[model samples]
Target: MTETVAVVGGTGTLGAPVVRHLLDRGASVFVLSRNATNVPAGAEHRRVDLASGEGLGAALAGATVVVDTANSNKGAEDVLVAGTRRLLEAGAAAGVGHHLAISIIGIDQVPMKYYRAKLAQEAAIESGPIPFSILRASQFHQLLDMALSAAARFGVRPTGAAKVQPIDPDVVAARLADAALAGPAGRLSEIAGPKVQTLSELSRTWAAARGKRRLPLPVPSWGKMGKAVAAGALCNPAATTAGKDFEEWLRHE
Candidate 1:
């Protein structure tokens, strides 16, 4: 039997690759977003906003599995937590069998507000009636690059001495697509990069790649969030590693 998979936030960085993977796996793929104009041509595009719940049910109707890679950095509460609640309700109503949500690694351990929102998002998924699987991954290489570039504007890069195990989006997307196909396994194993590199090292490498020179500044994090990140709580040392390291990714990408 053919599987119909609905991918929320399918046009975003992480979500786009998952959509591609699902399509490559021969599943009938639907990309759900408020504006799906940029969604790839191979999959069906459904314009639906999770926050408002408009067209959500119709978009998710008859889906065998739903992969939620949706996220909002500025509106984490509205999009991550509350929007997930809305998705869960709609999925349950649509008789969706498996719900696969991609989350960040160490969200429960981190003290940041965004991490807290992710925790709430997880709670909503866990308590919902639908059978669900949640996969947590470390920071993405793109995100790390963005961070380095943003900090480089000041002529110095400050990383707060946080250690990151950054993974490729395509690798993370493939794993999530596989989990969606395999059905709900509850919380699956976390995925991470091959090496645990400090933010300073990543920033320096990124700067060098850009043909720019900047001093690596190790800024101390004072609060609990700082402590957790500094302690490497965001990294899953035991998780399976995938894709190229930062240097290799930079060269190819």
Candidate 2:
């Protein structure tokens, strides 16, 4: 039997690749989002709003699995935690067998507000009605690049002393696709980059790869969040590691 998968936020960075992988795996794919303009070519686009819970039940109908990659930095509480609860409610009503979500590693250890929201989102999924799988991954190489690029515009790259193990989102997306196919297994093994490096080192490598000479300013992390980052709370050495590191990913970008 053919499996039907619904990918929420399917046009975003990690979500886009997940749609491609699910398509590659021959699953019937639906990209559920508020705006369908950028939805991938092969998958069907369904207009749905996670925040409002509009169109969710209809959009998720007939789906065997739902992969929630939806995220909102500005509205983390409304869109991530509450939206996840809304998604789970709709998924349950639709008789969706598996609810799969992508989360960050060490959300529990990190005291950041966004991580707290994500942790709440995970809690929602765990306590929800449907069987679920959650894949906790490290920071994405793209996220680090975005941070470095933003600081580069100011003439210097400011980096914290925090250590990060950034993984390629494409690799993370593939793992998500596999999990969507593998059924609900609860929390899966975490995923991270092959090597763990400090933010300053990642900045230096990023600058070198782009052939730009920029001064890397060292910034100290303070408070609980900073201490957690410095303690490598974002990295998982025992987790599965795959794909390009920061330098290799920069080469392609």
Candidate 3:
């Protein structure tokens, strides 16, 4: 029988891919989503709201692994901290074997609100009764796309002069699912893409992909340490992982 795994908030971008990755590994997967929407075809979906810790027990029951990809809309604290703690408690009660989580590289270096929440999540997972594997990766190229879309809102895209090593989200999803399936290894080595590119450069390249122009906008800090991010916060890549690069992902190679 295939092992069962529950993925919290599996309806979103990162979580959706993670669910697909787990299913590809032959694991019977359970996905929890906020709305009754976009449920993965091969997986079971439980309509649960993580914000209130509602309906988590029924979804997590009898699972070998529970992965937290559920993010909070109320801010990082609600999702990363409160939701993670709740997941840990529920998983512990359910006798879940492992808890897998994804974090970004500059959680510590950047001092952003999201990273701060992620750090709280890491701490919560570390102290959990269940075993856990925490994986840190750099930005996803979709972030560029999201930014571009936001800029398209006002007929202008904002590109910052920051260095980013973007890996394919599908690759990250596959690796994390594999790690979760192989049993608990605790915190894994940080993972990153092969090439590092500036936001300005990547934005331009990505805009060209969408038949748009790239416009770099110099702005002050917005998040926790925005200036620090502009100064290259996520600077190191994991020695292992050896994932594909941005160009490779873009070319669909």
Candidate 4:
């Protein structure tokens, strides 16, 4: 039987690429999203809400594997933690074989609110009834861009002393697809970028690429969060690292 993989949040930055990869691998791919308009071609799009758990059963029906790339920075406790619980319940009921989730590296070590919610989310998956694989990845390039752009909007370029390994979302998507195909492997080795650089350096490089001249201010208010960032918890040196460097990605863009 051809494996049918349902990607929750399949229209997202990381999820969309996973959907495309599954389609290329000859798997029957179902993209579960609230808005289905932007789903990849050759994949079935089902309008469903992960937070509300509405219309999830039909979206996940007959799925061999389910990859959850769903994320919500706002109300992460309700959306990521409770949302994952809802997904696991629906998956177990629907007879989904394996459940795979994408998480962030160092979420356990970080003292931030969102990271705490992600840890809670992982716990929910761990205690759930279905077999699961959780793969933690580093920050995406877009996140850095978004942060810098937000600061730029306020006429300030906020750089930082913290470090990050900004991996490509496409690369992260490929690994996620591989995990779904390989079935349940428990908590797999993390995935990160090829190079580790400071957030300040990355922001300056990004600024130069975009021909923007602004003062790069080191964010002093990161507080304990800054300590976590400086500790290099976000970079997994032992994990399988595959992706272009931040500067390389910037040059291409």
Whose lDDT is higher: candidate 1's or candidate 3's?
Answer: 1
| Tens-place lDDT digits, model 4, residues 1-253 | 6789999888999999999988888899999888876786799888788778889888888888989988888969767888888889889999998999999999877798999988998899888999999999999988988888887777777776688889889999998988899889999889988878887788788888877878777776356777888888888877647677787888875
Q: Model 4's lDDT to the true fold?
A: 0.86
TM-scores for every predicted model = 0.96, 0.97, 0.88, 0.96
List, residue by residue over 51-78, the lDDT tens digit for candidate 2.
8999999999899999999989989999
Q: Please, what is the whole-model Cα lDDT of each candidate in the order they appear?
A: 0.88, 0.91, 0.77, 0.86
For lDDT, the strongest prediction is 2
Q: List the residue pairs that clash in candidate 4.
A: none
lDDT for each residue of candidate 3 in 168-253, tens digit (9 for 90 to 100): 77777888888878888888888777777777667676666677663556555566577667666775644324665655555563
Q: Name the lDDT value of residue 13 in candidate 4.
A: 90
Worst 10 residues of 2 by lDDT: 33-42
lDDT comparing candidate 3 with the true structure: 0.77
**lDDT sort, best first:** 2, 1, 4, 3
Per-residue error (Å), model 2, residue 170 = 0.9
Tell how far residue 179 is off in model 3, in angstroms: 0.8
Q: At residue 80, give the lDDT of candidate 3.
A: 77
